[model samples]
Target: MVAKMAACTGSKDGQDSILEPLCFPEQPASSTSAPSLQGPSVELLVCLFCPESVPLRQKDVLLKHLLLDHKLVIGDVRLIADLPKYMLYWRGRFLEQPVSDFCSVIKTNSTGPLEKQEDYFLLCDVLPEDRILRERLQQKRLEEVLEQQQLERDDSSFHRLCMFCSEEFTGNRSSLLNHMAREHSFSIGLPDNIVYCKQFLDTLQDKLDNLQCLYCEKTFRDKTTLKDHMRKKAHRRINASNREYDRFYVINYLELGKTWEEVQSEDDRELADDEDDDWSDWWAHPVSAVCLFCDHQSETMEQIYSHMKETHGFDLHQLRTELNLRFYQQVKLVNFIRRQIHQSRCYGCQETFECRDDVLRHLVAEGHVMTLPDASTWNQPQYYFPTYENDALLCTLSDSDEGENGETSHVEDVPVIAEDVSELRALKQSSVLNQLLKSRGCSS
Candidate 1:
């Protein structure tokens, strides 16, 4: 409970009026409700914002006023650090002046200087500041009241069923016993066990009747162990009839109106959706890596290793060996393509086949179409031979060799056209994978 204080209006005199009066409810003087803000009884010097003649009592009230009103910016008001040098009196008189001492007494109870405490403490050194003290006490009382209100809100009394199924401790006991016997099929006989015969018999009878599962017939000393049996699969399979008996979940029919089936169905649906997202990251890569595979730049061996392991069936070791071999192979093929493009000549159209073809099969398969001039002279639209494009002898002998020796001439004629150029272009434009490689800054 925070104490309430009236606004401070300035005094007519040139001095600052620091304190304000407060109104509090009349209570027994013995009540321990005032905020404990007693300072040392010693007459220590305090800083004042008025002439040196201003009374010390006024300074104490001013500190309390500043703390309650400007607590956010100025914390504990006792030690004057960056406080304003003007004072407004209760009668609304305003005076401005530098405090003569520029220092205040260090209260005995406080561990450090007043400035360090959070803005809640309204410190005032003057012993006679009764009006401000009363307000602080009232505020403390208010806080206690608020705390008690919060505790009242937290206490909830809903359906309170006894752990033993024999008796339902609802608002009515007779109806509970009748419902237990008729609907639950509970027995009436009590048991004979232990020294406290009547008390133990009553307790045992309640447990045996209330226990939804008779197959286990296990009477736990505590409710927690009995609940574990209901949840475990072994108990569920044995006491299948007890599936409908949930003590914690049962709600009063007069208050809630919710059925057990509705709550169970909602819980099962959420469990199924959570299972699919566990595998979402297995096949999908980050969107940024898509461009790297689209263009066939020579991929680093490490990059290819990761790509093959993730996208293809290959793992790290096999991918590493394959990638290293592929890199050098592509490099050699690109160089060969450059040389063939420079040396090749065309015999059919009398034009260089440097980077051209009558009609390339793979190129057409990739959506490129070209009309072949003559099938006999062109030899089934062969790949553009960079070397044979300018070599007339190589082009002339290429077709004739196939006719003369068939398989032998066909093998020998292969060198007349360089196929490595196409392979080089394919490797250059189709394979580089850009992945965030872990920096190898540390060694094992």
Candidate 2:
């Protein structure tokens, strides 16, 4: 257990009166309790307004005193880089000057009928001094973390055994961590993603020795019982609400006021919102492409190609080879033919017809399937976008960059998750997954 410190009731001023003492422990101690995992050690937190008040263990207790007695409320305590040092600096400053000099005061019941009024001080980074203090603390912390990261990366004397099996690992801490995850299915996270490897491992080892569940934090009778409970209940993961593990992750140190989970969750929320977005304005339409020779519409490019070859004796693919048409060139030719047919005109002989059917009859009767007006007549840039918005033919147009077997060569799309036809991967065999599957009636 962490050794509790003796409270300093000794006043800094000339006052002779003694006060009650408060005590706490410095971390990296031998403890079986939850506080041992709270990576950093914060010991003496002095009251801001109380000169004779002893140092407090928890910052919340000191904040309570300030809020209740001094009417001082600190805004966004989580945003403070270093709370102990921050409070100490403010404590000294409060002694020299009034809090109103650096704080914004709100008088309660300003416009109310009540005669009595009370004031509350908001101590945020709104003041220039506080903003500078927070920024300086953040810079100092970043430098220290970077230095520590270099030391950890270079560390090689690490030696530990697997948490589940008795396999001993040397050279780097990741070896042991990876072994525990692979063999025991206990993954805290990726090795490269975290810092303070030694202390984090120690905290987990302490919990295991104490026969505690990592998730629920419940004490068990024995190691066997604890392991069984964790496996059966799917409690192999660390507690989500436990702020103690914050220091172990490098992401917690990267952002000013956000953790890795918070950053990751923001991305997840955006994707979820995108999935939930309203697409009610969209209406379903036929997936049909129009024929180049006539007004005949087919659901697919293949069907249209077949109909043109049979009815008009026009093999567009053959003509494409004869003219040595590139991908965009083929697109423009098809679009030009379609436009001419729609306007009741023959594109090959440049003859106007009474209707679309008359133009198709004229092209076939005059044997103008292989004939054209000119290269410049059909190879315009305006045919880049298909004339018909629902044209499936444009999607299947072959390109030199699309390999020998281009988009015209169809391949069915398959899902990433393969069906239960063979053996399952190692992840699917995990106890946690098995428990979840069993709960959902997917496993017997």
TM-score of every candidate: 0.12, 0.51
lDDT of 2 by residue, 1-444 (tens): 222221121223323111111122223233221211135564577778885343434678778888988999998888777777888899999999999999999899888766677899999988889988988887777656655655665467888877677688888676677777767778888776677788888888889889998899999999899989999999998986799888887788776767777777785545546555787866875566555654466767778889888977888777776776666777888767655654566778677655666666777788887688788888776666555454566666653322365544332331133223323455567669687888898963
Q: Candidate 1: where are CA atoms >4 Å away?
A: 1-127, 130-140, 143-444
Off by over 4 Å in 2: 1-39, 52-57, 112-115, 267-444
**How would you encode candidate 1's per-residue C-alpha lDDT over 1-444 as one tens digit per residue?**
211111122222322222111122122123333333223223322222233233444555545444455341222343231123222221122123222122233333367676764423222334233234434444543454333333322223312343335343433222333344455444332111011222323443465456543447676555566656655624422232343232112221111223345444456655566556576556752222111111111124445435534543334233223333232333332223223222232221223332323212223343321222343332212233322122211111112222444443334433344434676566554543312222343321
| Clash statistics: count for each candidate | 36, 0
Clashes of 1: 36
Prediction 2 global C-alpha lDDT:
0.70
After superposition of all CA atoms, the RMSD between model 1 and the true structure is 36.9
lDDT of 1: 0.32
